[model samples]
Target chain A: MTDTALHTNSRSPGVIVLRWGLFLILGLFALFYLMPLFVMLTTSLKSLEEIRTGSLVALPREVTFEAWRTAWSGACTGIQCEGLRPYFWNSVILAIPAVAISTILGAMNGYVIAQWKFKGANFVFSLLLFGCFIPFQVVLLPMARMLGLLGIAGTIPGLIFVHVIYGLGFTTLFFRNYYVTIPAELVKAAKVDGAGFFRIFWSIFLPLSLPIIVVTIIWQFTQIWNDFLFGVSFSQAGTQPVTVALNNIVNSTTGVKEYNVDMAAAIIAALPTLLVYVVAGKYFIRGLTAGSVKG
Target chain B: MAPILDIKNLYKSYGTVEILKDINVAIEPGDFLVLVGPSGCGKSTLLNCIAGLEPITSGSIAIGGKDMTHVSPKDRDIAMVFQSYALYPTMSVAKNITFGMKVRGVDQETQDRKLKEVAHQLQITDYLNRRPGQLSGGQRQRVAMGRALVRDPKLFLFDEPLSNLDAKLRVEMRAEIKKLHHNLGATMVYVTHDQIEAMTLATKIVVLKGGIVQQIGSPSEIYNRPANLFVADFMGSPAMNLIPAKTKRNGTGMLIEIERAGGEIITLHDHHTESLPENVIIGVRPEDIAEAGFRAGEDVQEAECLVDMVEHAGADTYVVSHLGGRNVTARLHAETSAHPGEALKLAFDLSKVSYFAPDTGERLN
Candidate 1:
């Protein structure tokens, strides 16, 4: 008789029961975590009167988008009635270039450190890693002075420069760890194939970097987009990001509380990061584990 | 004729830890030289030094009669196949083959022509659009060879290229590489730890041990006349047996004596003109020791030995016995009908044996 015939095909009843029980617990935790988002959505669809009269968790009886419209175009933020439209565009501009520049620099730094290693490569990598640990509050004053000396203080470009510099450490760390998993022979082969440093990085390394690229984009976009401290400290009124604007709209004490508008504005500020995660969430998980195994 | 590749007194080290010491070797234009040794014997390091991948600490390398001591690998007019098959995981088989040309700014027409030629030559035209990750191990190996063949460089380097393949595939690829070398007449240097590979594929074999060259010769020369104990022991399957023997001058020849475990001393005679040392090592290959009367030679000597084990390997049967306090293996005909614990008469081909000085492991006479 074959050894395969001796194996049992069915799992035990206790094991099946235990598996279902574990899934039930996981479902309950998922619902618990999503309760806040459900409340926010329901509240955003209610009128001011309905929001005040109705319970927080109850579905809105008369749905309206008036709160959303006001939050996007007409709400008052720090004595300005221009709302989050301009600031939303500012965050987009800030995040796109900052994510792009930092990610490119990170991949190059990673390639050099991982493959074309020079003397003191480990030292340079450790120094960059040390940068990831420094608190953002510690670098704010010196960064402000540096921005002033560069003569672009309180501008969108200044903010972009700040973000790129600050985000570089994490981006570089991500890329270096991922690139190290690639065999060193690939670089040697490319070098023997008459490819210079930049050419190899462009044609060979960059194409293999999709998973880590998605990972870095999601990480950098979220960090730069939701950054309230850098946004508040480094920007003028016109250059403020949506996080700072959202804060201003939520904290204003000039009139009766508008919970519905505040809720709608907070969701709008968070929508881009949420959308990015939704679109590339699978790749984000894949990229995280990609470096652990070799091909 | 001037040799195509000349390496003069090359040395490589890492912070005083020498990996290769005074490596000097050369081959003619169409010679297939193989660097062979056990792992960590600096065979791969020597190959890397020739390809200009690793910088040498001292001495010079000349390829095609031109000094290339400081040239980069790409400009050295050489192509290499890595052991891992390093076929650029992100590229299609076609792009992987043509990427080198693309980087050097070759015209697209030439790139397409070369790619098609190599793809057809390697019989990988159908897999041109498939990425390396999608291909099997043998297919990836073919693509790697295709990548090197497309260059048509003056020199080719292979760093244990067949070590990653299965045993069956390794044999197949070994034949293919030999055929490629024959057809192209390319000056190629291959490094491998497999002695059989060195024997089968190399026009010239260099045996290395502990960062030093042990011997350099043709396969028959290496097999029949090993320069040292290491080469004799390393180059053959069921390796050459070096038995401790006592020798003395006897008229026009030397008389040898080997003491067995049971106080029995087996004596043999050899034609040697020089006075011999009191103790010397007698080297005999497994095939040289056979059934009595199996080998016909004037120098054939017979001895009775108790068989310790018998392994039937289809074409030849390996019989194990004790000689001079060491386990010695002898290859006999397949239908010998030998059994364990039985005494058998074995013939030693004295003419084919080698003599080594017992002190320094160096060849004697």
Candidate 2:
């Protein structure tokens, strides 16, 4: 019955026109959002002289890989003659460990808070949740002092520590809400089946956490990779992240500004987060909305 | 041998409000003990207390001659099937069934062998590779049972396990569970608010109300002789008819007078009348009252009642009539021509009647 209704609806001229109209509106929005990426790609492919003379919206007259090469290997950022290669690796190193540590810690915290009821559990959860609302700037002074006291000041590990500590609140919030939707009876059943604390979590909860794990990884990865304040404040000369390096290359004062390199560096700095969204964006939405409706 | 399960002086309370009070219950090995009650009656709470999922306020729970009051649930040596079936959604049927064994570090050969045995026993071998989400509700229920069955624990706890299935599936699973119990003869504790499930599945039944145990007896004893007004009203499909009547002294026995809604009085003689109260409630099962012509036995008293309505159930017809200022239903043969606005003679079996003091709702005789 529904199939016939759908078939008849599709055959109507007004329905076809309305559908095409909807597509046209969506196409316009897509073009509007893609305009900046198009301009950046075209600008990165053009020579400096062509860029100075040509329109910003025009396609590249001659596509070239020169800007990408220079941005990755040879472009100078501040006093460094090398390019974003080392700093890109630094960001990768920092974000992987940061995302991993925070996600695992958050999963355990969420498991305890959601499943293991103890005295003052709700209070502790509320306190941890309160951390998510604290602005990043509010914690900079105290965090820097703590990092200095720990003797890892201006180091990559110090930056990692900062990200994990700061990102834990969001990760815990995500995981706890998601885990709350799982029936408490599963834990009870496992308990009766002779499964202990770690056994139940590892054998039961962890395997079921795939969607939320993806969500936490994406969220923490993007937040840490794109971070500028922590990277600029907590890093030494060699440990600067890709975002800081990109900023330096774009804002350097001693030489002629290479617009192509600047655009290429910007896109390079953003490629990880963009690729993450493209690959796992579906689960991000699904995991976010998972526990919204009570099952 | 010691009783398989024992509870003494169990009390569960949350802060100030008490949930369970001074509960004492024990069952021998292989007894199918069912805790049946209405919602908020603490049946589920008592089940959890037994499973060690919830701590008791003050009590000692011993299972298989071992003290388990303070022991953790994993160390309590019990298995439970939840109302929602609580299958690990991410695991296949095989993994779900063998998870407990794998956790205890059982060898692969034993785990696989036990998994195969339980899967086949529950008739879910074909769905061993399927995730719980892929199967239907009844299939998931079977897998839940399989998960518990593989453990072969000393005590099995089921909390309304069949309540989640549809009506037909619930009936089928009910029979299956009964068959499993009969075949295995395993000591089990089941909790449910459905009295029918309790009647059909339990060898021993505990009826609870408002966090207190009302009565504990066999199914026949609970059906034939309820301890109080609550049990008489709670059990049975059509519910027992409770009629307020007046009592007077006779030669040695007593004379019970029940006034109908139209002010017609019917008197009955009781054999045991020592210390009988002036006012009392008479409890009788619906099937005990039958058409006058169809029933002829000792201690039977016949009375003509104004039929209010007639419900034609397939095997038996229910005749609702006015008696003692209340609606009394009598189960009669389906071919009877009893109808509304007409008088029908119903024979009340006095031998099976129960008398309770009207004030306390406690059984008098």
lDDT of the structure predicted as candidate 1: 0.91
Sort candidate 2 into its docking category: high
Q: Which ten residues in a row have the lowest lDDT in candidate 2 chain B?
A: B267-276
Q: Clashes in model 1: which pairs?
A: none
In the range A16-114, model 2's lDDT, one tens digit per residue, is 888999999999999999999999999999998899899999998999889999999888888886889999999999999999999999999999999
Taking the tens digit of each residue's C-alpha lDDT, what string does model 1 give over B1-365? 89899999988998889998888888999999999999999999888888888899999999999999999999999999999988998888999999889888899999999889888878999989999999988899999999999999999999999988899999999999999999889989999999999999999999999999999999999999999999999999989989999987888698899887674788888884356789999999999999997888888989988899999999999999999888899999999968999988999988888989888999887
Model 2 lDDT at residue B116: 88
lDDT tens digits, residues B284-365, model 2? 8999999897778767889888899999999999999877888899999989989899998889888898888888999998
C-alpha lDDT (0 to 100) for residue A197 of candidate 2:
90
Q: What share of the true interface contacts does each candidate keep?
A: 0.88, 0.90
Give the per-residue lDDT of model 1 (tens digit) for A129-221: 999999999999999999999998999999999999888899999999998988888988998899988988998889889999999999999
